[model samples]
Target: MSGVGGDDEHIWRLAVQKDGKIVAAGHVATAAGGEDFAVARYLPDGRLDRSFNSSGSLPGTVVTDIEGGRDQLRDITLGTRGRIVAAGSATLPAVRGGTSFTVARYLRDGSLDPSFGSGEPRPGVVVTPMAANDDLDLAESVVIDRHDRILAGGSADADGRFDLALARYRPDGSLDRRFGDAGKVLANVGPGSTDEDLAGLALQPDGRILAGGSTAATEFAVDGDFLLARFRDDGTLDRGFGRGGFVITRTAPGEADDEIFDIALQMPNRLVAAGECDQPATGRDVCLARYLVSP
Candidate 1:
């Protein structure tokens, strides 16, 4: 669909409401050459749901400028009471590795939820810097737990290297101190890996968490492997699962690159991951892998 001024738009995630309305979150280019977080709602018939953001300039869409900089929502999850939680990264031009993990909650009508992040730097928005030095931090996947807590997963820079990172937030947009250290957890799937990024997140029936992404083998490696990590409710690694709570898989033969961009849990005891793998003859090929969840 057309975005703000029909500028370049990139949708990163979509969710269907209980009533069959489709909600999409992404980023739209701005006149200043920056990007803004954009959300739109559509009816089941593929028509814009003008019922959303009715009073706003755009009938069915809401565009937010988190910091007057580059703000994009890479993932969105529908929470209880029709609340929408979106997560991604916010970047400022002046700071080194300026990106920070950003999350915003919106009401069903596409307006910012004033109850969240009300007293923070910005109302209805939460920006988390994973590193003290302003290193790059991004939240690519988001999920709401049974308790209504929000969980965002992506990558955090760790001394120049990237590690799979997860952050949990309370309903009020405050970091849940009960989760991981200070509400944040970082996992390095492969030792010596230069980059480890989480692109998908899932919650198990038992309250555990699953994260899937990719890990590059070396500093300048062109090849990567699918990486998976499981964690307990409190955010510690689930040692009983894959080797030390992490799994690395090479989807293709030889020194090909493989990365998992999304993951889903099967009913009983299986997990499926989908992404892309470098194929020797066909360049890049879609790849899917199923794993048996350890009892």
Candidate 2:
């Protein structure tokens, strides 16, 4: 489901069958709230999941319409026992910066899982920003690990720069400190660059990690470049993956102008990266390339 309308509109997180068929989808539009938006669900085969919110809709009470805040769902992943986990952000007066990262879990039947995170299906996991300036911190991606742990990735600016921040949570919605400091890790990437940020992340079946984003020299817009880093399950840099667990993809001949928005893994340690490349000659095109992990 997707919200269609204005700046506060959002789409519903969907579930698909193993055969690549969309079983259910629904969205809560801003029009339903006058100025705020809500979440909805759909059933298998592109129909509304009526089981959700009595005809497929659920409004958030934490961020009320009177709070001058907006709520939106970002990504969703299915969990064990028919549980669903979703990541998003909501602005609230109670929070230090008026916004906080939200994660919620739902039962297979589309009901909020009271067993998770204070009975809030959304943000079954929660990680508030460290400072007031971090009102925009949000979780962009989420995945489950072998141990039933949940991993989340996004950007934050508590220290200074907009660096990549990662968090891990137990299935019960508690933080996982074994992965990073208080279940969170941050990487600046480009110390002197204008804007350093992480875009996407993936976990290798073998317990390795890959994160992709952009980097620049001196400033974010002066000359951008693609950046990828690989880490071990213990959160240590994977020296064998790239140059010290890092790969910088830039325009051929070193003009230094490109950005990576997504990445995927192929068999036998082969990887495919997709994004945009501001090549000197090609100007810019949908960038796609393959790379083999170095021996």
TM-score of every model versus the real structure: 0.95, 0.77
Could you tell me how far off, in angstroms, the CA of residue 214 lies in candidate 1 after the best superposition? 0.9
Misplaced by over 4 Å in model 1 are: 93-97, 219-221
lDDT by residue (1-295, candidate 1, tens digit) is 4856336899998999999999988998888878899999999999999988999987999999977778878999999889899999999655544799999999988889999988887789988887657788888999998899999999888888888899999999999999999899988866565678788999998889999988886631367888889999999999988899988898778767888989999865789999999988898899999988756
Candidate 2 has an lDDT of 0.60
lDDT of candidates 1 onward, in order: 0.87, 0.60
lDDT of 2 by residue, 179-250 (tens): 767776766664443456566677778777777777765433346677787777776677776566677777
Q: What local lDDT does model 2 show for residue 234?
A: 70
Model 2 clashing-pair count: 24
TM accuracy, model 1: 0.95
For model 1 the local lDDT of residue 24 reads 85
